[model samples]
Target chain A: MTTRERTDVRRLPEKQVRDVAVLHAILDGALQAAVGFQVDGQPFVLPMACAREGDDLLLHGSTGSRLMRTLAAGAPVCVSVTHLDGLVYARSAFESSMRYRSATILGTAVLVPDDEKLHALEVLTEHLLPGRWAELRAPRAKELAATSVLRVALEEWSVKVSDGFPDDPDEDLDEPVWAGVVPMRVSYDDPVDAPDLAPDRPVPPHVRALLDRS
Target chain B: MTTRERTDVRRLPEKQVRDVAVLHAILDGALQAAVGFQVDGQPFVLPMACAREGDDLLLHGSTGSRLMRTLAAGAPVCVSVTHLDGLVYARSAFESSMRYRSATILGTAVLVPDDEKLHALEVLTEHLLPGRWAELRAPRAKELAATSVLRVALEEWSVKVSDGFPDDPDEDLDEPVWAGVVPMRVSYDDPVDAPDLAPDRPVPPHVRALLDRS
Candidate 1:
């Protein structure tokens, strides 16, 4: 949160939203986030699975990875989560755009100490997979050693949403062409059991619930 | 492609792929990409609609924006496109991961000249909207003036794909617990016409084709 002024959306100011709930909503809805960080003035962005817990965004990766080690050591980072909701079909190619909700956070991360690491993992698992966490076995000590859990606070952030119709000029709107939004969404297919799973084992309810909601 | 060595995937070398076809497939399947660029020592990653034209990744935005102006002027950039195919369920949390195909291209962008701007726009439109570009009206001169088109070559890049089942150890595999991948995909619902459109006008074929594919 060092440079607070940089978080403002200068391109399309009207799309900029100042609501914390909107930020949290976008983060909660997204499964992964693109994290940007610089090393020796060169920027690197990698996609990582993420979950939101309270006012923080939880990220986990192999402790051996350079990104995890650098971020865990409190390097400045930019985390962004975007959802492309739909495509806006305008009468003119210039006015065409996409409907999307995005949230970007600017700050460093705090490593989850060894004592609280398990709880943090639990929070992440439950948020992403929901009821399946309780059904799964506990993580072994060796498994925990190889992973690093870090949390970035939602202190300095900006959320921008473009969900409405395209703002075409009055002249363009009168054209005989058809124009509207083509809605898009994430859908889940049937669960594919592992080849190693016993044939008698049935798909869990929590997993089925995901498809139902979809 | 300034530091050529930096393009190597040092973290997960096993997942790193050197095939150009894989990179093209990943970029073609994705709708947007997270572009990272450094200003001073601060890093920023923003999601932008992207299209792949030959060996170049085409990007367009308002010429007035700081990012567009900076990237258009040949600033170093790292563009990443990731498609999360499914969630991998493993016996232990340590071995779990997502099935994804990601391509990272590192280079500076070259601005498309005024003469080629319209062609670049057409390429982008056709890639995203498919057959709709032929039906849409041509871009006016004013609209072209307000936009900036830039293309980044896929010269120094890396493709990483993790599409297999979880790589759990032999001991963990013996457990009777079920584990597998829950497939995920982007689906489209029925397209809704604009409220301002003529009530009798029917939906276009190209837009409907998208839903059919989904």
Candidate 2:
């Protein structure tokens, strides 16, 4: 999806903005994100396992979570996703930096309607477990009542990014220092089976497929 | 180093403040984070590639970035680090959720003094590239002058985390749905050598060692 077109005086310059494409990449690649907000002048950030549902982000919390209650009051919020691409080492300390992609969305969240909540949940499930949704049982009424689901539109956002090698001072370029980017990434390692699983139960096909891909 | 004493918050009872030890784990393990602040009246949250530098967080930007300039103005700022620990697949769609750990710090920043800037740079260097700082050239006067370094104390912060599997409704627990956590992590693959490097130049010991540790 495209980022918001509007610009503000405080916005990062075009070059920095262009780097924002990395932000989208981080969000699109992950299964979850951390959502931030200000409550009573105090800041609160919660890491919610999330899924991008269509043009909106679907987040679920316990029914009585303070974050959920705050959003229910229509408070403005910020959702951010970031992926650390690499560490840039320059000839000099001033030029050392990181290559990263991050996206921040600033907007108010609305509770998902009863009818749409199920779909959002499905999207979240698939995003996390891939094939588990079809195999799992659906939520009952009481369970639905105990959960709080939020849908935030991905408008009014900006992405800022930095990449490439360090930009050393001209004079120090010849300094006998090694310089380059050391990359980093998020990965899924071997899975640990649940302690309570039945002895004869084999790894499910979906889980096996995901592990194999990794 | 420990997270600030007053900045830790607990997830149980859902709102009490905890200790820094708990907060430290969240900050240390988060996969990504969004750094937020205001320039003039507009809000900006840039996802940061970060690592803890003692009790302070080391954030790097362009030599003359808007973010650095604004932060140098002494306005209050918020930095958040988050990791999506797992996806909580419950019996029902509404019960589906994610487990995560996140830390948020809110405070004013001080432009690190010139005398201490070098030390700050070392903290960042070691955090990002480990042993590369000794291998790289130090910053020259002009290069150091051109860069901005700001330090925000970890006071007035809070970390909220959730782990384990989804808490499905009692009635739905019997519903033949699969439930569990799909764990996540940050990993590194094989390193790619720079094309400009002399063909005979071997990978440095420090760089090569990161593969085993990172």
Of the candidates shown, which would achieve the greatest DockQ relative to the real structure? 1
Error of 1 at B134 (Å): 1.3
Q: Judged by DockQ cut-offs, is candidate 1 incorrect, acceptable, medium or high?
A: medium
* Local accuracy of candidate 2 as per-residue lDDT tens digits, A101-158: 6667777789887888777777776877788778776666876777778988876766
DockQ values per model:
0.73, 0.38
**Clashing residue pairs in candidate 1, if any?**
none
For candidate 1, the chain B TM-score comes to: 0.96
Give the interface RMSD values of the models in order.
1.3, 3.3
Which stretches of candidate 1 lie above 4 Å from their native place? A1-4, B1-4
**What global local distance difference test value does model 2 have?**
0.64
Model 2 spans with C-alpha error above 4 angstroms = A1-25, A161-177, B1-19, B25-32, B38-43, B49-53, B62-66, B87-99, B161-182, B198-200
- Candidate 2, B90-176: lDDT as tens digits: 556665555666667888767888898778767666766678777766566876777556777776777666676666656655555
Per-residue error for B193 in candidate 1, Å, reads: 0.5
In angstroms, give how far residue B80 of model 2 lies from its true place: 2.0
Cα RMSD, model 2: 4.5
What digit string (tens of lDDT, one per residue) describes model 1 on residues A127-172? Answer: 7776767766789998788778889999989899999987888887
